[model samples]
Every structure is written in structure tokens, then in C-alpha cells.
Target: MLNKLSLLRNKIDLLDIKLLEILSKRLELVKKIGLIKNQYGLPIYVPEREKYIIDLKKKEAKKKGISPNFIEDIFHRVIKESYYYEKIKKFKKIKPDFTEILIISHDKKISYLFKNMLTITGYNIKYIKEKNLNINNINYLFKNIGMLILDISKNFFEKFIKKLFLLPKNCILIDLSPIKEISIKKILKIYKGPVLGLYYFFDYQKNFLFKESIIYCDGRKKKYYYWFLKQIEIWGLKIEYMSVIEHDQYVFFIESLKYFFTLIYSTFLIKKKISFNKVLTLFKPISYLNIFILKNFFLENPQLYINLITDSKNNIENIKKHLDYINNLSFVIDKKKKIKIINIFNKIKNLLIFNK
Candidate 1:
């Protein structure tokens, strides 16, 4: 029996070697494809092709009596790895239209991420912490800067608004604040140059830029910043143009409200003295997902979430209205108004379904 076990292990080791060789060959092909795509300024992610490959593999797996879900899980990881390798492969260098880009942010992680991403694409990038910004350094740094990215907190940006005159007149200014209303208003008042507001909707830690979404609002001259938009597209981000008021309104619903509910739920759990481990053992998928989101939220700086929730008066007022609605629902439930509650639920369900 021991000898049989040894033989089985050896067979598995041999199969692993073959699998590695196949993966290496596949990655080589992916790199070549990346090169060709870069040459033509094509995007890295093709959703249609990805969907076709996964569906095809799932069909083959079912015929072979393997679990289709198992095959799907494997292929998804493989495709994600393929995308990472494709992006890291040497890109066809495009000469940047701008001279030097300056990134100002209090957050080191965000600043460095931007610096690294732009630097790899052959753009000259400089970074300065918000604390380091002064009249002298601003003059020195803005001398050759054709593009200025403001990635600082909203509060800091407000305080720094008066110093906008230090920047060169021709430099394109881009704001990366999540809440756009205040920043856009303040910036427009101070700076007359080409301005753009960008809100990134992906994890900053992601290694590849494939299919990431960026919602941008036009602030000033579009012609001056057109090349900058093209540069971002070449790096594989999907851009959506929105008005500043519309962007802020959506952000209130999507980000501020979502985080507010998560916080309330977490507080309820804590107040009830619920054991998180016991909850995990219950094996509820939806609960698990909620817990996962809550855990991830706490991993980031709490101040970031606080700033997001309290950034605008509109967000605060909207959240209050939601709470009032919830209170009315609770009163209806207590009064045993089954017919009214049913109507309300149906209306909400239809709204959600119709939007989808």
C-alpha cells in the first residue's frame, strides 16, 4: 500500500510539471498578444472574448463529467493572471504630449500608485506631499509641470485653494476627490486653466488597469485636456463623462449611503454581542458577503470613510431622509398593516428590477 501511494504521488508530480509547461506557453502567447494590442492602442480586456472562453470551457467540463462551477473558478483565476502578465509585459512606448506631471496628495499610497503607473508609461512624473506644498516649492515644481493632479483630501484642497495662482497658466489641473461639488466650485473660482475632475471606482491596490472605471466631469477647456484623456484610455481605464452635480448626487447614493448602512449593521452586531465566528458557522452566503464587505471596509483608514460620509450637506440630508423612510416602515410593521407593507415592498422591488 505504501509503494502504491508513492507511485500515485509521483504521477501527480509529473502531471504538475506538464501543467506548468502549458501555463508558461500560454503566457508567452499572451505576451505576444499584448505587444500587438499595444501597437494598435487597443484595450487589454475584451469582455466578449472572456465570456466566450469561459462558456466554452464550462460546456466541455460538463461533457467530461466535471463540475462546471469548478472549471469556471479555475478559468477565472487563469484569465486574471493572464491579464496581469499581459499588462506588465513591455508596452509600446508612446511619447507623452506633456512635459512634466506633478501629483500632490497627502495620502502616500495614492500618490505613489499614480506616480508608478504614469512613470511606467514613459511620462515624467513628480510627487509632493500636501504638507510640503509652499509658495517657494510650488513655484519651483510648477515651472515645468504641464499637468497637475490634486489627489489630496477635500479639506486640504480647500485650504490650499488660495495658492492656485502659483501654478503655470497652461498646466492642466485634475482633481481626484470623490466628492466633486465643493472642489469643482472652489477650483473654478481660483484657477482659469484647463481643469478636470476624476473619480476612480476601483481598488487602488490593483496591479493592472484593465476595464477599471473612471467617472470624470469637465471643468474647463476640453481641447487642452483631450490628450490627457487619451493617455488614460491607452492605459486601459474606461472613462465616463458626467456633470459635477450629477456625479456628486450619484456618489451620495452609491458610496455614502452604502457605507452608512454597513456601519449601522456593524454597530448593531456589536451591541447585541453577536459572535462573528458563530455567524460564520451558520453558512449563509449573503451574510458572508456582508461580513466580507464590512471586514474590508474596516481595513482602510476610518477617517477616509468618515470624510466620505460627511463630505457634503446633500449626503447628510439624503441619509436623514432614508432613515425617516425606514422609521415609517417600522411603524407600519408594528401596526400590522400587512396590505400597505406589501404594496411598499412591491413598489421597491419593481423600482430595483426596472433599474436593473
Candidate 2:
């Protein structure tokens, strides 16, 4: 009986190997289909076709006395993989219109940082000093402008607003102004072009790397979005598309509030007359962790931080509502409920490894 059991186990292992080989062959065919679709300018994911294939697979599985749920799960995973491969292939085929990026800025530090970042990616960048940008000669300024970087001071933005309308209809705008949402809306009214608002604070000398910038577009332009995404990816930067309101709310809660609390904590520490060295010694683990975070994530640009806080202050009512919701949260632990939750998690873990 033991010999028979060993033989059966060996047979099962052989069958598993054969199944994996067949799946590999299937994935090769799927990739070929993805390539063909890309060549024809067709969408990679067709829900109707996917549903039909899955339904046919289910019927075949049922006929073979196999579980439908297992077949469905396997096919869903295959579909997901196909979608991912197809999207990557599509991005590889995109041809951007222009190569030169025109940056209009007076801030030497900020412009220099951007220029260096873009230059590494083989992008030809032209800098037009803010003083040189005049409303009278706006047309001359936009001669070969494919991408325009707007980084003017908030105080001087009013004069530049009207001149932005003269930008060629196809030119992409990257606005780094203080008030982004309002500025983008006004620009979109006249210049029916791609507009992106990028917000971040970074100072390499100070070891402050608030390198994560949130991006929001004025309209739904997939081509420009894809182009910008690829360029930023080359620079090792991260971006996500979100509504202006959602972006502001996220910045308010995540950044401004965190900075405010940090200030409050530091004030109390100073009041207690605790030296930096004493605090570091007292809370070695936490101090080390916070130092790492400050170097990696904290904003060093006071102007940007203040602007974020000011934006948050403008939405005080919404912030208060969220604060009230936070206050309502409880950390009470009930033994029975905790046990039930643990059991549910265990069941989920088991389900993940069910077939295996």
C-alpha cells in the first residue's frame, strides 16, 4: 500500500509539471495576441471577449467534472497578467510630439534642480527667465515651446496669466505656482491644452528630500499623461492622477497637519529644556526613525509648507469634520471579536494556498 501511494504521488507531481508547461505555452500565445492588438491600435482588454472566454472555460471545466470556481480564479489571474503586459507594450509604442521643454522661472535653485533632472533623461531644456517673459512678446517666447514649465512667484502671477493664453494650442503646461487649482482652471478656459500642476519641496543641501510630488491635470488627455509619466519615471520620481480637491485634502491631512504636530511637539520639548542630544539619547529608536523620515520625507521649503497649511486652513470646515471623525475612533479591544477577526484572517490565508 505504501509503494502504491508513492507511485500515485509521483504521478501527481508529473501532472503538475505538465500543467505548468502548458500554461507557459498559453502565455506566449497571449503575448502574441497583445502585440497584434497594439499593432492594430486596439485596446488590450475587451471585457466582452474576456467574459466569453471565461464562460466557455467554465463550461468545459464543468463537463470535465472540475470545480468552476477554481477555473474562474485561474483565468482571472491569467487575464490580469495579460492586461499588465499589454499596457507596458502600449507605452513602449508611444511617440511624443516634441522634445524641447521651456521652463520660465526666476528661482535659480528650483530651475537648476529641474534642469539637472531633465538633462539626465536626454531632454533638451531651455530656461526663459521670469524677467524676460513679457506679455507683449508672448508669441515670440512660444516659438518652439512643446512643454512650458511655469514656476513664477505667486506675487507676479497675475501679469503672466493672460500671456499664457498665447501658448500654442498643443503646448503642454506644467504649472508650479502656489495656487494651482484656480490657476489651471483659468488657463484651461483660453488654452485648450494639456496642463499639469506639480507640487513638492526639496533641498539637497539641507538633506531634505520631500521628493514626492502630487500631479493633477486640467483635462482628460491620455497622450500627454503617458508622456509625462514616462519622463518622470526616468527621473525616479512618483506621480498619481487625482482631482484637485482630493489632492488638496490629501496634502492638508498628510503633510500640513503632520508638520503642525511636529512643530507643537518640538515646542513642548524646548519648554522642558531638553537638549537635542538628550532627546536623541532618551528615545534612541524613535529619534533615529524620525531623523530618517526628516531626511527622506519632510519639507524644507518654508514657503511651500506655509502655502500647504494656508490651503488647508481655507478648508477648515472639512478638516474639522475629519478631525471629529478621528475623535470618534476607538482603540478598545474585545477578546471575542478579536478572536473572530483572527479566525477570518486565517481563513483568507488558507484560501490563498487552497490549491497548493
Candidate 3:
């Protein structure tokens, strides 16, 4: 009876701690929004952006197994309070709100995501339909706009990046559909494509492919491992230096090639349509878990999957090697080979958990 009471007390303590944590997060976000507005000279109350954010909250909540309506009601109250804070400024100095945010994209789904994500934060969001927006007039159009989110569609971006670069604001640019450019021209007497302008190169058209960088856009906006360190002066994050070309090559090799081969292998395994009971006996728990994660990621972004193959060098070699090893697997295979693979798996497991 005493033990049960102690357990209940512990649970209560945990609940209290979690409640404090959530409050802390809310306060921090409030401060961050205020700071960002101060730094960028933007307003605090933006209805359009707020609507977009609330929508995103609803969508994201559904994914995380939360009620969208609950998130919406909570955020609506939060936004109103924030607006009052900005307008009153009785407690402290408040920043002015931005009236315009221009998003360029052809995909309606992504536009909806962006629209909803911004509403909770309260900013004015705008869109210039790709077809209606003039390529040459982008510079003139951006004269008064505060923030610009480019979709990085090559056909669209190639015509106006130079002009957009001239805007005198804290422009945060993210390339959505970046083509990995080749870098051999300087030393090999081959053609090198321009990095930041109209002369951008893609891997599929090249005679000999090389990669320059790997760019990934997970849901949250954060820098990649290699990019953060190398660009400390500019990006001020942790990254190790590798040329964009090499990065793309590695991504193509590891991501593009491996995904294709494994997908094929998985398909074959399923095609035989063997009994689930039999398959479970042969399956490794760790392998099954890894496959589950990979399946989710693959389904999330087709562009990323395709880019991995079309954007790299040396991927084919790696894919073939792994596939050969996979195909050669049999119940009667050498014990030494089995042990080697097992040791490798153990090492990976250890390395992954060591830091955590």
C-alpha cells in the first residue's frame, strides 16, 4: 500500500514537471516572436499569417494524435493576447508587424502548409501565383515586401535570383528543388555550372556527374551537419566542410541508389507472398524497425528520393555491391560472412546509442 502511494506521488510529480515545461515553452516562444519582430522591424499582428498558422496547427495536430480544434482554440486566444501586447506596449517596447509575405509555389498542398503554419505566429502572408508573377518585374515588386519564400523551381528561379539578391532585408532563402551542380570544370577542363545564378547545372544532363552539396528540408528549419560548421561565420552552426559537389555525390550514392535497390528487394520479398509466419522467423527485429522508418521517409517526399539518384556520383557502384550481398544471402551461407555482418550491425547499434 505504501509502494502504491509512492508511485502515485511520483506520477503527480512528473505531471507537475511536464506542466511547467509546457508553460516554459509558451513563454519562450512569446519572447522569441517579440525578438524576431524587433530585429526585422515587422509588426506583431498579422491576421493572414495567423490564419495560416492555425490551419497548420490543425493539420500537424492530427498527425501527432492531437485534436485540431483544441490547438486552434488555444492559439486563437494566444494570438489575440499577443496582438494586445504589441498594440498596448504598456509592459515593454513592442515591434511593428509586417503586412506582406510573398510565397512562390505551384504546389497547392505546400502552399496550404505554409499558409497554415504562419497563421499561429501572426504575420501577413501573400502569394504571387507563378503564372501571374512576372520574372523580370520581381525586383520592382519586392521593393516593399519584407520576407520572400522562394519555391526554387528552376524554370521560375533562374530568371530572377540576381534581382532578388539585391533586396535590402534579412532575406532567408531556401531552395526547394535544387539541382546538384558539377564541380570538375576548374581542374578537369570540363564545364562548370554557375552556383547562384542562371547558369545552374543539373546532374542528369552531365556527361560525367559530380555532386556539390546535399540540401534537406525536414519539417523544422535547421542547418545540416556539414553546412553548419563550414559556414560558421555566416550560418553560425555546427558543420564540417565538404564541397557541395561531394555532398550531392554522397547523398546520391547513399540515399538514391540504396533506396531503389532496397525497394526492389522488398518488392521481391513480398511478391513471393510467402506466409507471414515463415517470414517473421527469418526477419531480424532491428532490420524490421529500420525498414519501417525508411518506408515512412520515402513516402513523405518523392522529390528527395528522386534527387538522391539523379544528383550523385558513385551511387550505382554502392547499390550494386549491397544488392549482390543481399541476393547472395542463403540459410547455408558461410558462418564467417554471417558473423561479419552481425558484428557490423552491432557496431552500428553501439555507435548510434553511444552519444544518446
Candidate 4:
């Protein structure tokens, strides 16, 4: 077994060296071609040429017994990174002819954050206030904008939708999910694909990728994170469609509601002026576990505590559900009740594991 393992490692090492040499030669040739293309003032990227190369690579990958999907992803990132470097170097040489995206919002802080993210992701981002954008003549912006990031919470949804109807079918209209109710997803489906709001999350290796353009979330990074992002692009450079209302609805169940419950419990203790010592004395195990979760939320995403509670379309009534249940003790006193509680707890725990 040891001998076989050593032999396999040797084979892998040789393959790695061969791959590096091949890449070095390919890059040298690409640079030579780039020089010629530069002299002739040809485009930095030729989409047709790219398509042809991808087709050829797909055939080769099949012949080599490689997973085409895996090979394609590797090659796609290689090509994208190469071009990204070129774009940065010759930034002035290429400007997207189309407007790409136009953002109109009532909140300047949120607007600035969204625009900055787009700029980093290599887009020409533009913005206008809601009232000014509502004019009839400037509707041309909608015609060419491939994506729209609108703030419809401040009575802007109807007006934007009115103008957005003029845009072409392939042109996408996007809105960041608002904390308030903004149900434009169903309406925009007429001319757009999946919704792209400010927040998207995907598991990447052991870490996570988060984009908080909507509710003012922070940036996250991991090795596998970019791979996850690139995978999402197949569905129109985004993962899923969501309106501001839809976003809030989904987030509430997955995130906001849990945070709210925990925050309220933590806050209630603070307001009533209860000490950590009292909690440890009464419900040692439950109280200790709860505090661990509570402390992380209180300290890390501290802003989240503020944003979620103050959210415009927040289900204050649903939050009341947790509070209503809080005082209802006498849980599982009898042996039969204890058995039922344990069974229910185990089932819920098993369900969590399976879903994850």
C-alpha cells in the first residue's frame, strides 16, 4: 500500500510539472499574439474566436477522458483571468458600448455601496435619483441598460416599472431586495430573467460567499468563493431571481427571523436588568447554549441586529410568535412528555442535518 501511494504521488508530481510547462508556453504565444493584435488595433477579446476555442477544447476534453464540465470551468476561469488582466492594463482601450446598468435609489448610502460593488466587478455603473429618473425623455437609459438596480421602497417601483416596460426582452431590470415590501419580480418577469438583488450566498469549500448589496452586508472571501460566483453566471451572471419583497420573505425564514428572536431574548434580559449569573443558575444548559449563539450575533454582525429589527417589511407580528411562546414553560415534565420531547428534538435535529 505504501509503495502504491508513493507511485501515485510521483505520477501526480510529474503531471503537475508537465501542466506548468504547457501553460508557460501557451502564455508566451498568447503574449506574442497580443502584441500583433495591439498593433492592428484589434479587439482585446473576440467572442467568436473564444467560442471556437471553447468548442475545440470541449472535443479534446472528451477525447482525453476528462469531465467536460470540470474542464470547461477550469478553462473559463483561465480565459477570464487573462482577459481581466488585459482589461485592467488597457482600461481606456475598451469601454462597453452599452450602458449595462443604471441605479436609481432614495438612499444615498445604499446606492453608493451598490455602485461600488458593480464597479469592482467590471461594469460601468450609473445612478440617478428617483424623481429625476421618472421623467419621460430619459427613458432611453432603460432601453440600453442590461441591468437595473432600482430602489422601489420609496414609491419608486410603479414609476420605474412604467418606464421599464419599454426596454427589450433580453435587457434585464434588477432591483436590490429592499428591507420593505417591493413586489416587482412578477411584473418584471415580462422583460427580465431571474432577479439579482444585493444579497447572494453560496457555500464555498468550508467558508461562505456573501454579497450584501441590498441590506448593507459585508464582503466575504474564500478560495472556492469565486468558483461559486462563476457557476452562478450561467444563469445570466446571477444565481436566482428575487424582488425586494421576495428577498425579504426568503431572508426572513433563513436569517432575519432567527436573528430577531435571539436579539429580543437577549435584549429583554438586558432591559429587565437580568444578569448572566441568573441565566446560568436557572437554565444552565439551555441558557449557556443560547448565550453562545447570542454573543456571536451581538458582536460580529452587530449591524445586522439593527438592520433586521428596524426593517421596513419586517414581520413584527411573526416576531411576536417567539415572544408569545417564551413564557410558556412546563415543557416535558412527565416521563411520557419527556419521551415525546426527546423524540421531537431528535427528529428536528435529523431534519436539519439532512437538509444541510
Which candidate should be chosen as best, given TM-score against the real structure?
A: 1
Looking at candidate 2, the ten consecutive residues that score lowest on lDDT are 203-212
Writing each residue's lDDT as its tens digit, candidate 3 over 225-320 gives 222112221111122333445545555555566668666766786798856466557779866865564566556656655655544445567666
Across 298-347, the per-residue lDDT of candidate 2 in tens digits comes to 44556655665565445557556656755443231333457656776799
What is the Cα-based lDDT of residue 233 in candidate 1?
Answer: 74
**lDDT tens digits, residue span 24-57, model 4:** 7777667766555544444456567777877889
**CA lDDT of every candidate:** 0.84, 0.65, 0.51, 0.56
> Which one wins by TM-score: 1 or 4?
1
- Point out the higher-scoring one by TM-score: 1 or 2: 1
In model 3, what is the error at residue 245, expressed in angstroms?
Answer: 5.6
Report clashes for each candidate as comma-separated counts. 0, 0, 25, 2
How accurate locally is residue 285 in candidate 1, as Cα lDDT from 0 to 100?
A: 81
Model 2 clash number: 0
Candidates 2 and 4 compared: the better one by TM-score is: 2
Q: Name the candidate, 2 or 3, with the larger lDDT value.
A: 2
> Candidate 1 vs candidate 3: which has greater lDDT?
1
